[model samples]
Target: MDPNSSKRHLINQLSPEDLKARLANESFKRTTVSFYKYVILDKPEEMRDQLFLIWNKLHCYGRIYVAKEGINAQMSVPDHFWNEFKEQLYAIPEFNNVPFKIAVEDDGQSFLKLQIKVRQQIVADGLKPEEYDVTNVGQHLNAQQWNNAMDDGAIVVDMRNHYESEIGRFANALLPDAETFKEELPEVVEKLKGKEDEKILLYCTGGVRCEKTSAYLKHHGFSDVNQLLGGIIDYNRQVETEALENKFIGKNFVFDNRLGERISDDVISHCHQCGSACDTHTNCANKRCNVLFIQCDSCRAKYNACCGDDCQTYVLAPADEKESLEQRLVFKRGKRFYKTDKSA
Candidate 1:
């Protein structure tokens, strides 16, 4: 077999349990970081393979997506190899000096293995090539400038999904009831129908989403579009360093194991169950119906870490009845699961 193919086989053979065990035995600390760029690539698959080999050697682990458009990655690097990792990454012409958004809170075990795959686009915006000029993005505003804009009553919009923004956002931002970025673009355009000429600001978890969203807004004739420089990650760092007023409240939702990081001392959202103040997000403990939802500590204990009473009951049910129970149930509002068709 070819050398690269042999290595790929070795990598593919490691199961999730194997990766977890390996991570548990590690003694060194790791740093979680993320970065993205919209530069064009000639061969994304080749680039993916090359990066996997290089980063795997350095013991770097994170979820990464590469495409003809560019790369979007969130990974953890061993502390000792941080400098070497940066050097190797920046050596590539397309990614040279690409700004990194370091995670606000990191325990180093955010990812257990390195997984890279080639996709059509780095961030899925559901747009055609000729639909908009992505390079024509909004003005980048640092923490201080963003605060100033907010003080001046600038129209701020959360470019992320409803789940993300539900946990945290800038004060008074126009949040669209969207589940994905694909849905958000058109919704935002429709929401600000009369204010197309207004100074609109867009922001997301990292700066990646806004890079494409700002351009999409511009294509729809929104003038004076701006985005928070480096999104909330860098904004938090700057706010702490410069002693600027933190206009954003609540947690900054992230995609890694650590679901979110605190940017302020406020919990703007409530527990989806008990309605108590909470911003912590977790997937339903029921592996079969792993819906993402929020629960308070009390509720978490009451539901046995599942979504609600129904899921908790199912979890406690006999193994043989699990499949039959699940097949006969449907999701309900108060109780996550309930009997619908008894045929099963």
Candidate 2:
């Protein structure tokens, strides 16, 4: 073996601050794009290493998950390298012809660094292998068809977790009070117990969760299960292009650094701190208590961008007493301080 080959590291070693600085200093433009494909991979670890090298060479920055079942990725690529990135990625047999969903609202600073992780499953549905057949998914519907179904009284269900749907969803969609997909699956089943044969329309951020959810519904004897073809992302895109009636209201929650993108001007959700109308999701400034929550500009200033008074005190406390203060304060809302259990 060559001695120089030992120096090749497959992971990023830069700190977040350094990565952000590097991105800030760059002169070129970047485009935010996301794509996922559920194709079987014999050796995910090897594939991960290969992809890291490929993407790193292209100066791409984003998060990607690889598993035996498939791969899911969301990243920003330099505009100059976009064509090359597409060509090289499409050259891979497993991901050949995979559809790309470009961010409708992009600021180019979506990600600061590259992170490719190997997981047991890409989306973390928490199910045994025999629970449902992914290959046997529900019918895929475009924006027009989905709207028509809604017009005909088809049941609309948000397949995302509580925090995601808290900010936006279809006008009459059934929003589950689930914190995780594993919990949501059973909850949805119970909610639709009596209407197994009725039309079910499920949607998520980028259509990945709905892929599994639609199949799970079918496994539980749901006959007319359907999903948004590309989820809220594509639905919004089509709603703009085709000039269709937009049924979705508020911001569409995302997993990137931006957190979310606006789908409409309506601020349906309220600030978790003050109950003021706001849809902006932000994490507490207190590093130790980085709970995700919605905050308006006013509460943000009052709380110093922390979740609540306790978190704000903890953040402002001197470094010596910070630990003791954290120990003494029994946070009013527990670990996830701002999480809501209420559902529509």
Candidate 3:
């Protein structure tokens, strides 16, 4: 790696306090927030540069993306500076009050730096622009309301990937056994082809996927489709507002160091090995196939963080020798062996 890239990568790994202080005595305490807007952007690179300059000044830290289709953002800025963040977001014609979802748990270390990248799709669905009408989305519902709709025989489908749904979902939500975001979207739609007018509830980690997904369903003739307003994040938020019981159970898996956040007293997902109902998600400790995934405490120890015995040796291998061993393993088995489930 180039020295500059390596150094930048190292900086992004700093601790929360160190990162806060290292940003050079900024004037506010950061409140972490996240949201995505899936609208067409004319100039992705220009959009990326423009947001970077504006956000870097606010000491914002998290990830954001811009594409020909739209934008997705997960960021932290000073609590006092939230207005500034909001203003900057709304200044762009497309992002006005665009419903961003908050994470269920607040970790001081959720993000270390601000990053903006330009991509082809905000969330890669591998579909052409004309595949589905992206404008007409489903009905929106708050936590309490969504739960009520579920009671009325709504086909509550977990709108996240299988692993994500495995950890947390609405009670009895039909999980699509899907391994990817794009696949699950169509799968969920196909599964409910004839049930267009029935109450349909959809949800995901931060609710952005459903923005386009709900639109797709609406285009496909699904009438009474609805989604959790802010997804799990907003669900947790309203859980406090109405003092409603947490209808969703277990831990909400996240894409950061803090892993999963608590939503209720119930524990749903079990340790893949020991079967203890823990919601913590961890990557396989094996360096070669370090799949970003979920595992519980007991399983963490049992696998020594590797997820399986094949990975165990790789995790224990000396750093200098690890590369050659990885090459050899790959040369012998190809990518199929790497795809084997190591989800403990």
Using lDDT as the measure, the top candidate is 2
Task: State which candidate has the highest TM-score.
Answer: 2
Question: Taking the tens digit of each residue's C-alpha lDDT, what string does model 1 give over 65-108?
Answer: 99999999999999999999999999999999999999999887
Report per-prediction Cα RMSD to one decimal: 3.5, 3.0, 4.7
Clashing pairs in 2: none
lDDT of every model, 2 decimals? 0.85, 0.88, 0.73
lDDT for model 3 comes to 0.73
Winner of 2 and 3 under TM-score: 2
Q: Which ranges of candidate 2 are over 4 A from the true structure?
A: 1-8, 331-334, 338-344
Candidate no. 1 TM-score: 0.92
Give stretches of model 3 more than 4 Å off. Answer: 1-29, 327-344
Q: What are the clashing pairs of model 1? A: none
**Per-prediction TM-score:** 0.92, 0.94, 0.84
Descending-TM-score candidate ranking = 2, 1, 3
